[model samples]
Structures are given as structure tokens and as C-alpha cells.
Target chain A: MNKPGNLIGWLRKKLNGISRLWIVECLLLLAFGAVGARLVYLHAGPNEVRIQKAQDASEFTKSLVPFRGRILDGSRNPNILAISLGVHDICANPQMLTAATNTELAVSILSAYLKMSKEDVRYKLRFSDKKFAYVKRFVTRDISERLWTQITNNHIKGIYLEEATLRSYPQNNQACHVVGFVNNAGVGSLGVEMTLNSSLTGTAGVVKGMRDGKKHEIYTRRTEEIQPIQGDDVILTLDQQIQYFTEKALDDAMAQHSARAAWAVVQRCRTGEILAMASRPAFNLNEYGAETDMSRMTNRVLSVVYEPGSTLKPVTLALAFTEGLVTPETMFDCENGSWFYMGRILRDYHPYSRLSVADIIKKSSNIGTAKIALMMGDEKLHKGLRAFGFGRKQGVELPYEEYGILPRLEKWSGLSCSRIAIGQGIAVTALQMAGMMSAIANDGFLLKPYVVKSIASSDGKPRFTAEPVVLGRPIDSKVAALMRYLLARVTEEGGTGTRARVEGFKVAGKTGTAQKPVPGGYSETAYMASFAGFLPADKPEITIVVVVEEPQPYHTGGVVAAPVFAQIAEQTVRYLNLEPTEPVEGAPGAAAPAP
Target chain B: MARVNRKKNTADQQIIPPRLILTVLTVIGVGMGYLGIRSRCEQLGSEIKKLESSCEINQRRLENEESKWAGLMTPRSIEEALTRHGLNLTWPRRGQVVRIYDSRANDLALVDMKDAVRFAELERVALNE
Candidate 1:
């Protein structure tokens, strides 16, 4: 403002300042460019790109596949008791479905096809805010296919199929109790199903797909998948054909005897594997709803508890003989058929003048048996019974097995001891009785009974296998053999179990007629008749126990139960194709009186 | 005093370089960007693992259902199904039988139990006459 030279100098200084500012701007831009280039290098580096690509590929390919296990039989044959298939949970986007063409008609058609009511469909469609709602779960393949056709043909919108699983039993009720039944969500409920549920229930897989903002699949750009691990298959010891026959026989017996209930079991004598176990009446596994709660239960040969009657006599005799307190020739006067102890009178079914230790068993004399028990004393008898697996669980591979009642020696009065000696006052289950018989047949060695043979993975590799387990030897083998000989006579010319004779088979068995316990004491009319025996008396194969409760005309074990044993033995021998032995000539007739 | 001032002014006239400042700014910016990118990668990896596990579970469930369906839809089961639905297959009676031939011996015989009985009766009547 003061001079021209001063004004030119100020303008030059301001222009120079603007040029320096531009140079500073250029330096800042260079720094930013280096930083941006470094960032790009870090983000798109080889390591980072490789990791991203691997992750995307894995996510895309791994999610949607599943592998389930198979259920196989003893022969390694697949009997699909339960399995999985591709199915769908029918769902809908309620708002979309409502806005679609022919909404009412679509809902009506879906409801009819799915067996759901149109009202339910309409109610779901009314939920406008709900992005998805399920109409039904676990639709079958046939139904799903039909639905897919219907949706395509009718142009229904928003109805979709999602993958799910459904369990089915092919044999249905054939092996229902053994194979067990699975629930709606594919959980095992009973039998082998529950036992091996963990191995049978394979791991479930998931599907992850790229989705839009509304959670709809957008071409599935990336998916993450993991394959499921299938469960193991269980192999049972049950022979299906044997099981069929056992069930048929039990059903017929139950109907013919007008029995309230009946149960039977056939076990391998050497090995404790149960070949067949049946109870009547039984229900179908597929139609579980149609059965009553009572029929749905598995008896496991342990449902009923009754006095073992004369079947217990052999055990007592075996104990006495083993203790050196009695010999086969040892004789008891039998009090001329009846004896009184502690104001209780015990009588034999037939009067015997005198019976040797062997004859007492052959005749099944109650008085004679009580006399032999008196010699055994309370402690040795109790120990012997306990060792024989009485008053304790037999350790079978089944649930809810009962340990029958055996009162302690201290609890037994003189009368109680005498009564219990002849199989009264003490109650035992049929399984326990059978186990006791099997122990004798197996040379005094008790075995822990089991039904499952092995558990294998879906690839046919064994996961767990069962072996024949010897529990304990309750008596000396010599004593068992002698007892076996005496028992064989019970099916001979003058024995009580004359009716239990099988042709060309040397049968050894005992007959039991236990009076039913009434309100006050015992009933004379009602009886629990039982016959327990091992076939081919010299060398045993199978041991069976047949119990008949309260027959109409005759309630004696020899008359009611022994005949059933004979029939079962004949059939079993024929079916097993067992080598026939020479018949015991002059075997007593079933009509003959007990000797 | 004037000569000393001239030498000091010449020393101050040397220019400062911008490389040091530029290097420092570039390091700070790159470090921050790398951290952000690393965090995004970790997040995606975890999400992918979760999705993978879920997919595995679903796949197993689907396989289990498929085997069950195949088992229930067998030929034997179909025949049983028909029987359950009350459809019975019956054989023709003796009067409807045509003839029987023994394949091994090439011998012709009566097909029906009733016809065999009738032929046996005719033989007995002829012998008696």
C-alpha cells in the first residue's frame, strides 16, 4: 500500500507460501500411497488368500451329508430295525404363503396331503411376522415325494422341505421286546435299542449355506460341512426261529390253560446264552399304542414269584451229600408218610415205609426231604442255597430282574425250616429256578446268563463281544453227578415225573406242586405246578423249566406241568437234531400214581 | 562478529529431507490395516467351524432315515402288507386241476387228491368184478 516495490514483494511472498503448501500436500499423498499399498499387500497376500480359499471351500462342501448305522441280526444280516433317510420338515414363510395365489386352496391341499387340518395351516399363515413356521416334522419319503409333486403341480409358494430322520422297525413285533422300540425323535426306549442306543444313534450333521438379508439361500456361495459318525450295530444271542416257536408255544399254552399270564425261557446249559425267552400275551412294537400297559412289559422270566416246591429238594439233597452228612444209601424212616415239627405236620404225597437218600429224591417225599434238611442243619443249608444263586440276582443281562426271597437261617423257626425244606414258605422266581437247574447241569458250575452276543460298528468291526462267564461252582462235581442220577429216576418207572419222558432221550427232571398262598395261609385247589429238567441225562445240551399255574382238573406238577415239559423236550430235541439215546425201557406211564 | 554470523547462516542453509516422516506414517497405517484384516479372517474361520459341525450332525440324521425306509419297503414286507390288508391268495380245488407230471421220470399222474382217490376206487371196483 505504501509503494509499488513493497506491494510486488508481498505478492511474491504469498505466492511462494501457496507453492510450499502444495509441496507439503504432495509429500502427504506419497506417505498415504505407501500405507495403502502395504494394506493391499497384507490383505491379498498368498497366505491370507490360501486361508480364505480353504475356509470357503470347506464351508461350501462339508455341511449337508449324513452317515447312519445299521441294525443287524446274529448272522450279520441287516434287519433295519431303525435307520435314517432324507426327509423334510414341511415349513412355510407365513407372510409369503398368505400373499401367494390361491392361499386357501394351497393350505387346503397341504392340510389334506399332510393329514393336518386347514385351520392349522390358516393359523400358521396368519403369523405374518414369522419368516418360517413348520407344518409337520419327519415326513416320510413317499409323502415328501407326493408333496413335492403337489407343490410343483399346484404352484404352491413358501412350502419347503428340510432334511430330517425317521426310525422304523422292519420285523415290527417279531423281535420287539429284544430289539426294543425307538421314540418319535429317534431315541431308543427298550430292549437292545435302549441298551445300545448310544452306539445306534449316529451323530447328526448340519448344513450352512450363503443366505441373503432375509435368510433365503443365495446360490450357496459357501457351505461348511462335516460328515456324521454312524452308530454301532448290536448282535444278539437269540435265534429268531427258536424265539418264534417259543412265542407260539407260550401263546397256545396261555390260551388253552386259560391262564392269566405265562412265561417260558430256553437257555443253553453250557453257555448261559438265552436261546429263547417268551411271555404271553405280547404286543406289536409298531403298534404300541394299541396294547395295554400290562402287555408292554418284558417279563424276562422273572415276573412271578412262587414257592419252588419239590424242585428245591434236589438242592438240599446235593448240599447234604456234598457236606458228607449223608450218602446215597443213607435212609430216613419218613415217619410213615407224615411228620410233625413245632406243631406243623408235613406229609409226603405218597406214604413211604423207608427211603434211602437217593429214593427220597426219586419219590420227592416231603417228609424224607425235611428229614434230610434237619441233618444238614440251618447254617450249611442256607450257605448251600446262597451258593446255588438263591436269594440273589442271577446277573442276567436284562433290567428289573428280581432276586427271589430266601429268609435267613436266623429267621427260620423249626416249622419254617421243615416247611422250607420241601419248597414251601420260601418264594423264588422261575428264572432263578432255571438258573439253579442249569448250574447242576453244567457240573455244579453257575454261569451268568446273557442275551447279547456282540456289538459291532456299522463297518462290521466288533466293538464289544460277550463271553461265557462262569459265576461259581456251588457244589462238588461228584455230588452233582450222583444227584443227576437220582433225578433221572424221577422220570423212570416209579418216579413222580413219569409224564415228562421223551422218547429215545434219557430225561432227568423234577416235579413241583406248590400250594398258592392265600389270605390266611395256603389254598388246596390252586397250585403252581412246575417241571425243570435237562435233556440227554448223561450229557446235557439244553435245560428247560415249564411252570403251569392253577390247571382246571388236576393241579399236581407231574400231571399238569410234566406233560408240557415232555412235549417241549420232544420238539426241542427234534429241532436241535440232537443225537438220540436208547430209550429207558419200562419208563412209568403218566397215569401211574407217584411212587 | 560479522564473519562468525556469516558461517552460522551458511550451516543453517542446508535443507531437511521428508523420507523419515514418510516412513514413520507408512508403518503406523500398515500396522493398523493388518490388524483389521487379521481379525476378519479369525472371525470367519470360527464361524466356518461351527457350521461344519452342524452340517455333520444333520448328515448323520438323514442317513439313519434312509436305511429305515429301504427296510420297510421290501418285497417280503409288501406281501405281508397285502395279507394285512385282507387280500388272500387261494389255490384251485381238485375239480379245477388239469394234470400232474413227475419231472424226473416223465410220468403222467392225476393232479388232484380227489381224482387220485376216485382212480383208486375204480381199480378196486374192477378187481372185485
Candidate 2:
């Protein structure tokens, strides 16, 4: 109700009483309230989002690598065939490296320690735009330590190491095909490595954590962690010494005979464990990456098949003997080493008019064997061969093993019985031949062969252990005894396998010299000479088979294969310290003692 | 109103409460203790990191030594060493071995005396051949 001028003056008077200090205080209070409200919003409402934002800024996740397993031989004190050694992959942050002071000095030091060219090191280290590059991979522990010391002492920037593993074969190419090599991607590529890859490769782990401002992991802030598991170790049944002996003998024979290729297998007769299996043209595991020839990597003993020639004679004769069709004294007219049966001509290495069953085996008379097979006919012979584990895989631990060709009974042709009986028109692997010999040595029990002895985990827990598996009993124990007796004479005086005798022990064996089949007919020049045998015929300990492919000049089994067999058997018996069962020829205890 | 004002002034003039002072002091002490524990945890974490790295280095070193040992034990290595030393060692032949029979009293008898002599002759003949 007062006048406008009076009201204005009164308002001015009230405003003038309020000081600037009061306004400043009011502004400060407003700022504090705003700050408190923001804190409440972050700490109380939707706090998880703020926490997640902070973690995203500083947290990191890393994968942990697992260690691969090892392969060892089955010696009393096992030899390591393959192993995985921890190594480092030398890496660099090239952007930081290029910006680092004294970059040339660091490059020179790295090159010297890494044993690489200076240009390579500089090229890897001088990329200013790149964040990371590999300076070197799989650097050994010794070299990595030296480089680490240099880096720390000289304050070299951006150079770091990533942990990894390198698969190594200490024995080089000695058991190359048995203990295969690992590829660059940390995977097993061949042999036992390929077959047992899963157990040999372990599981990796994960670790998530928060890193500090300098990009260093803050271990206390680790959110999650898992421990990696190591792979299992595989132990093979090979004896290193015996393997050495067999390989050495085979090498010498290959050179002596000018052979194209050679392979051999040594097995324990009682237990079907392969002691040594060697093939020529083997590739070195350490240098497998450089090898280009596929033939050299082939394990011919288990992978290749050929006509077994006369080696199958003993099997046929054993079947005849089992069916009570013939005895050691049973006589057969050998037709003077030539006979016609089912419109096929059968001939012997020697022309014998008449021979006992035992002499037929001793002299390797094909006509006598065919006549015996004619008596037994197709049904019994086919059943007997199948029972000897011919048509199927032996289920050995090796990879890519072929089941050698064994025709079925229904597939047999008119001349199948006589021809198959003489070891023609039927194919067999060297392993199959050795198994057949082992069956006889085991008293007619056909045992499955295996090379891997045991597999154990990193914690010493057994994963797999091999036990001798009896596949089948083909012949009776009595027939097996008679077969062993007749086969023993094959290595005695006037026997075809006389060269296979071990100076002081009786050897039971068969010799085979098969012509390599060509397009239209058999090759007259190329032959597979093989000898399959066991020592101390009465109580056999070891069974050995040696096959030499395409030997020149001398192609007969006794000439090319038996001597190698003799050398191996002699060395094995001496190495095993096997007590001599027979006296020396001129020893006082011998029937014909020295004067 | 004068009486009320006098009561308020009296209350304001009283000494600061000991419980309030203790509470303020305890809050500062707890903050300082939290700082101390946090710093100790960081220091221990750094030490653990260093120890873990050293452990990894030592593990690599041990693996290297083991691989070297295995390589040395291989037959090829042994044979190379023997050849380098010019040692032509060979296993004894069967003719060179002598059998000894043991009895209950631990009495050992050498068997095949005549055979041993004959073996020597045979070895001589083999050498001649």
C-alpha cells in the first residue's frame, strides 16, 4: 500500500544489509551438497556398475600353457626317447623398442645372445608402428638367461619372453619310427606320439587379475586361477641294447648284399612284447621337418606285405601234423623236386625223389609240402591259416599297420590250396611271420604283439599297462612240439638254414626267398629274402625275423638273411647271458669231443 | 527467553566431551591402520611375484639339466665316447664263460673243466679259420 518509490527504497535497504561473504558461503554449501549427492549415487545406487568400470580399466586375463609328456624305452633303467623342455619365445614391443634409448646396443646384445643375424634382430626391433613382434622363438634356457641378465642390467626396454616348450629327441634317429616327432604346433605327428596324443597333451589353465598402472600384474587382485595339468609319460617295450645290435647287423647286411631296403623285428617268445623293430631308410626325429621323402618314414615291418615264400611251409606242415595226416617219419614222394597239382607246377630248391616229413622241412621241399597240403585239402588249411592270425590286424600299438592279404576260403581258386600251401599267392607282413613263429614257440598259442609297455601320468598314476594277450590256440601242444622238433633240423648239418646256427645253440627256423611280383609275372631279379627263427629250439626265449629286400647276386634266404640272423642271435644270447644249452662242437661234453 | 538463552550458552561453554574426542581419534587411527595394511599387502605381492618368476626360471634350468642327462645316457652317446677313447670292448663269448655250481654250505664247485680246455682249443681253431 506504500508508494512505489518508498517500496523500492525499502527493498534496497534489505538487500544492502546482506553481505558478499554470505553469498560466498551459500555457494560453498551448494558445492558440498552436490559432491555428497554424487558420492551417494556412486557408492549406494548402482554400485556394481561403477565397480565394473574400475575393473575394466585395470583387469587382464592370461592363459597358462601345459607341459607335454615324455617317451622312454623299456630298459631296466629306461632311456628317454622324447622329451619336452621349457623354452622361451623372445618377443618385443617394437614401438617401444624403436623409441628406446641405446636401441642399437640392445639389438647387438640380442643378436649375440640369440645367435641370429644382426639384420634380423634389427628388422624385428625397429618397427616403430607395430606393438609386438617375435624376435626369436624357442630360445634355450641358457641363452634366455644371458639375455635376461643383459636386459635387466642395461635397462633394455620392450624386450620380453613368453614361456613355451620344445619337443626333443635325444637319441636322434635310433628309434625314429617308434617314437615319432612332434609338429611345430605342439602336436604329436607320427608313431606312438600320434597314437597316444591325447594322453600326452595336457589341459591348459586360465588366470584373470588386475594389473597396476605400469601394466604389471597385481597378484593380490587375482580374480580367478586354475592350475594346468601336465601330460602323461609313455614307456615302450624296446630294449635299447638289443635294438642297437639289430640295427647294426641289418645295416651291415644291407651293405654286404647291396640290398635296396631291409627291416627286422625281435620279440620275446613267451610274452608277445616287441623288443626291437627297425626299418631301413628311417628319418631322424629331430630333423623330421627337413625330410621330404615319405618312403623313409614308412615302418616297413608293420606297413609292408609280401609273399612269404617258404616261411609259410612250416605253418602248412604243422596243420597237416595236427590233423594226424603226417608224422616226422611220414613219407611223401617229392616227384624228384617237381610235381603237378591243380594244373600248377611245384618245384623244390633241391631235387629229392622221396623224403620224410622232417626232411621235407629241412630241405625246404615244395613238392613234398604241396603233396601234404593236397592231403589236408582246402577247408583245414584255410581254417588253420586264419587261426594263425593272418587275415586280421595284430592290434599292435604302431600306427598304420596293414592286415596282410589272406584270401578267404570262399575266394580260393582251383589252385589256391596247393599254391597257398607253398607260400605263394598269399601275402604276409614281417610281423605276421614273426607272430607265426612265436605261436610255435609259445606251444601253439598265438599272442597279440604290443610295443608300448606302460603309460603313467605326471602324478605317477598308472593310465595304461600292457598285459600279454593270448589271441588263440591254433594247434595242439603235441603238434607244436613235433613242429619245433622238425624245424630244429632245418638249422642242423645238411639243412637249408645251416647258416642260421648260433655256434653253441640249436636254432629252429624257416628260410624264404620270394620273387617280387611284377605287372604280368614275378621278377627274376628282385627278391625278398627272409629268415624267421627262435633259439634253443626246445625252450625258446627270443624270436627274430629278418627280411632283406632286393639283394643283389645272392637272393636265397639262407645266403642273405640267415647270417644276419646268426649274428643277431649270437649277440642277443651273449648280451642276455643265456646259459648255453648245447656244448661247443669240440667241447669235452659234446658227443664228438676234441681229441 | 532470557533463561533459555542462558541455558544454551552454558551448554556451549562446557568442555568438549571425551567420548566424542575418543570417537574422532579412533576414526583417524583406523584410517591410518588401513593404509598401513594396504601398503604391506602390496609389498608382499611384489615379493611373491619376484619369487614366482625366479621359480619359473629355476624350473626351466632343471628341465634343461634333465634333458642333458638323458642325452648323455643314450647308447649312441656311450658308443661315441667309447670310440673316442679307443676302447674296443666286446661282450664275452660263450666259450669264455665258466659255470660255478653252488651247494647248501655256500661251497662253489667249478663244473666242466675238460669242457673249458676243449673250448679254448675250439676258440683257437676258430681264430685260425
Candidate 3:
């Protein structure tokens, strides 16, 4: 305000000094601007590189996604014994949650939905300075949706959801032993699940996205993603209908006989395919946690071994006939129903004064069968048993199959040989008995019993198909036919297995009444009654074995096991629509064929 | 020379201002928001697909259970299952049976058979008796 030209002389001096000071200030401001620009360039250069590295890290993590597969049945029906369903893993940052209003309320609400304790939830929310912490795992879709709604309505912050898989079993207990179950991490635990786990569990997928300072997804900076590849499907050879029937039957028998346990198997003789197999006291696959006992988990049809009893007599008779040591007409004196052989008094159920080889089998005479075994000797008997698929595993694909006990010839005593001849000393599994019976039904050709028919990939292409493997043909076709004739007579009126006679079909079968061994000798009260047979003796098809343990009063094979065989055979014949060759003259044509 | 100077002053007054560049930048900002919305919609679509697949898996598991339950519920399946386990259904015996016969024989014939059936009176019995 002072400088108009008036104080020109004084103003000039002051203006000159101020001008110099202004020039110096101008230079200082330019220097400061240059320094600021340089600092900005330095900071931005490193930040750009850091941002690029972070983007690459996200891309790397996203590439590891894998896909899971499906499970199917023999009919190509989806078994889905275990499956992966989409779920969410919920997480939160406790420190950030502290600022959230009604924090305790939020924790309680989440804990209730997640099935966790409020204290646990609160503790997780309180102690976490880490950017992320798991609040809950395996949250279902419904719960997750409810959580989302809660978040939206309440404006909750610091919550997140991560994709995960939860396994489910559809057919809870149906075919549990066969279909098996999975573990917590979606790993197969048993049966088909364990067998085909590698192909069924899929790879996990990932997505790379920029997260905010709180690790929240940034809408703008999201980038690369990789999708999970789904696993291939496994198709089993189990027939659901047959399996259900088998299980039901076993359950009833176990209850009826007051048996400690029981097992049964149905096999197609020609194909060696196990149609149905069941053991009593089965468990549900869904609630495996309820019963984790090892005994209940076992598939007894393949694992347990017991004396096959009189059911095994047919194999001995067949072997005797095959080796030309005996024929249908060969007679042996049963010594008025009792005989002393190898210091063991073997007795017949009936005092058949004299019995031909065929009659010996029809009456299930222990004395007569022992005589036949003595004639064949131990070497030939052992060879014949081995050839019939006895004393060996059936080579089924399932785990934990037993090779039933068969003492070598060198280990056999005089009494042991005779005892084994009547099916006393040896032990056999239900599956082994079925396989042996299958050999007789299959024209003396023993086959490897297999439950799984085929395994297929997800696309329905068969990865593997089971072919009929002939273990051995122990006897000739003629011998098998002769044995079948002899067995059929056992079911005739007044014969041992009169109870096993079916109405419209000629059933060939043998009965077994094995006394359970006690501390000293045999337990008089406890018995294992079993019946193994094939239908339409002339042209055999299905081979079945039924074993019942500890019947109340009538513990004989003919009394307990034979009746069960008749019932199953009757129903199965009707189920398969097997045409009867010898229909009764006045009987109604079997069951009318299903349309 | 005077005319040229007036023309130059008019030209200076007509020159456009540079402040309009900010309007272009604002348009770009709006475009970025629209793109963000579009990408979010696409992401949601993919998530829906994944969820659909998961639903299918669950449905299949339920179907398997239903089929098993159906099999167990059927009467035939139950009966057959019982038989398989070891319970045998017994047929009616003679004690349980009621036999009804239609009699056509005369009483005289019954009397004659009774008299002839006796051992001691065989020789003494008359035809009338």
C-alpha cells in the first residue's frame, strides 16, 4: 500500500531487497517440487512391481482346483452312497468384529446356527488379530443363506464364506457293506468307495481376487479364476432289489432262530456273479458313528468261516463218483445206524440197515459218508476239495475275504479224515459254499465268485468288466449229473430234506447239521444248520446257501435250514420267472409271469 | 495494421476453455462402475451354475434313499426277506384241515360190513343181520 511512485527513492530500495528475497523463495519452492516428484516416482515404481507379484500369487493359487466324481449301480442307477454338496466355510476377523454393534448377539446367532457353543464363538471372535479366522466349518446352504440374510439386514462386517464340499449318503444303510462309506475329508473308507476312491474324489478349484485391507473381496481388483474338474463316476455291479431281499431274509432268520449270527449268498452258477449276499445285524451307512464296532462292520459272508456240515457231503460224494471210487449203486453197510471208524463212532440219523451210495447221501448218513472218504483216501479228497474251490478264497474283488481252513493230507489223522468227510473238521465261508455249489450247478466247473460285475467311468464307459473265471472243473459233467440226481432224492418224501421240496420244480440240495464244538467235545445244544442247493436239478441255474445258527428245538439241517431253503427257492424261482419243466398236473401255472 | 489488431483480439475471445476435460473423466468413471456391475452379474451366474450341480448331487442321493426305502416297504420284499433270514412259513397240516366227504352208501351196506368185519360172529351171522 505504501508504494506509489511517491516514496520512490525509499520504495525502490525496499522493493529491490524484497525482490531478491522473492527470487530465493521461488527457487526453494521449485527445489521442493522436484524432490516431491522424485519421491513419488520412487514409491510408485516399487508399488507397481509389488502389485504385479500379488496378482501372480493369486493366479498361482487358483490353478489347483480339482473335480469330484459320481457313483452308480449295476443298473446305471445313481447309488450316490456318498456325494459332495456345496457348502460354505464361514470365517471372521475378531478384532474387526469388536467394532461391530451387538457383537455378542452376532456370535450367539452364529453359534446357534453352526451348532457350536456361544463361549467358543466368543473366544474365537475375541482373540484373533489375524486377518482371517474360521468361525465355522461345513455350513449348509440353508444356514449360509440365513447368515447372508442376517449380514444384509444387520449390516454386519468382517464375515466371509469359502466354498467347500460336504459328503452325503443317500441309501443310508442299504448295501452299506458293499457301497461302503466316506471319511470326514471325503475319502472313501470301505467297500466300493475305498476301491474306487482315486477316481471318485475330484480336484479342488480356486479363484484369485484382490482383497481389501480386511481381506474382503475388492470388486474392482478381482482377476483370474480356475474351475474345479469333476471326478469320474463309478458304476458297481450290485442289484439293489436282490441286495434288499437278501438283507431282509438274513434279518428274519437271525430273529427267528435266536441265532448268534447267520449269512446267505445267491449266485448265478453260469456267470459266477454274486446276485445277493447278506449277513445278519447289518448297520446303516449314514450313521456309522453310532456303531463303530469292528465286528459289525465286517461282511461276514466273505469273512467268517464255519463247519459247512452235511451241506459239504455232496462235494465228497461228487468227488468219490468222479474218481471212480464209488458209483450210485455202490453199497455200504451203515451197521444198524452206527459204526466205529478211526476210533470215532459215526452214526446215521436213521438206522438204514443197508444203503446204496445214492441212499447214503439221501439219508445224510455220517457212517456211509465216512466209508466213502476212507475209500478215496486223504490225498484224492484234498485234491478234490481244492478243485471244488474249497479251502481257498473265491478271489472276489472285495477286501477281507477268508480262505477257509483245510488241513493238509500230511496233517490228517484217521479220525480227522473221517470227520472232514462228514463236513465236521473243515471250515468254510458262505461265499465258499456258494462257490462250491456253483461248481456243481455249473456242470462241475468251479468259478470264482464275484460281487462286482463291472466298474465304469463317469461317462458310462466301462473301465473294467468281470469275466467268468473258471477256478477248476473238479468232476466231469456226468459225475455232476449223477450227484444232482442223488441230491434231489434227499428232498423227496421220507428223505432227510423232505422239508426242502418245492412244488413245481425238482430241487437238488444237501442239508448240514454241524454240532458246535465246546471245550471238551461238541455242544449238544448249539448247532449250525445249513442248506445249499440248486433248482431244476436237470438244468441248474441259481445256487444258494443258507446258514442258520443255534435253532431252538429242531436244530437239524433238515428241520431248520431246509425249510428256509425251500422258501427262498420258491420265491426266487417266481422272481426270476424260471419256467417249470415239471409243473404239477392240476397245479395253477406257477406264478403268472409279471408283465 | 489497425484492422489486424482488432481481428486478433476477437480470435483470443473465441478460444475455448480447457475445463471441459473433467467432463470426459467423469464419463469414464461412470463407465468403470457399469463394467463392475456387469462383471459381478457374470460372477453370480457362474456361482448359480455351481449351485445347480450341487443340488443335482443332493437330489440323486435322496432318490437312492427313496428307492431303498421303497424296496423295504414292499410286502413281497418283506416276506422274501423274512424267508431268507430263516423264518419258514408252514402250510396247513391234516390237524388244521377240515375234510368233508359226501356219503352215498346205504345203511344196510354199512351194517353188512360191520357184521362181516367181526372175527367170532363171521360164521354165525345170517344175511338178514
Candidate 1, residues A352-446, lDDT tens digits: the string is: 88899888988999998888888878888788888888898887656567888899888988677667778988888877887788877767777
Better-scoring candidate (TM-score), 2 or 3: 2
Q: What's the DockQ of model 1? A: 0.05
lDDT of 2 by residue, A339-361 (tens): 88767677888899999999999
Each prediction's TM-score against the native? 0.67, 0.85, 0.74
Candidate number achieving the greatest DockQ relative to the actual structure: 2
Say which candidate scores most in TM-score. Answer: 2
Candidate order, TM-score descending: 2, 3, 1
Error of 2 at B98 (Å): 3.3
List candidate 1 stretches off by more than 4 Å: A1-72, A75-139, A157-162, A184-187, A202-225, A289-291, A335-337, A524-526, A548-554, A563-568, A583-595, B1-129
Q: How large is the i-RMS for each model, in angstroms?
A: 23.6, 14.3, 25.5
lDDT of 3: 0.73
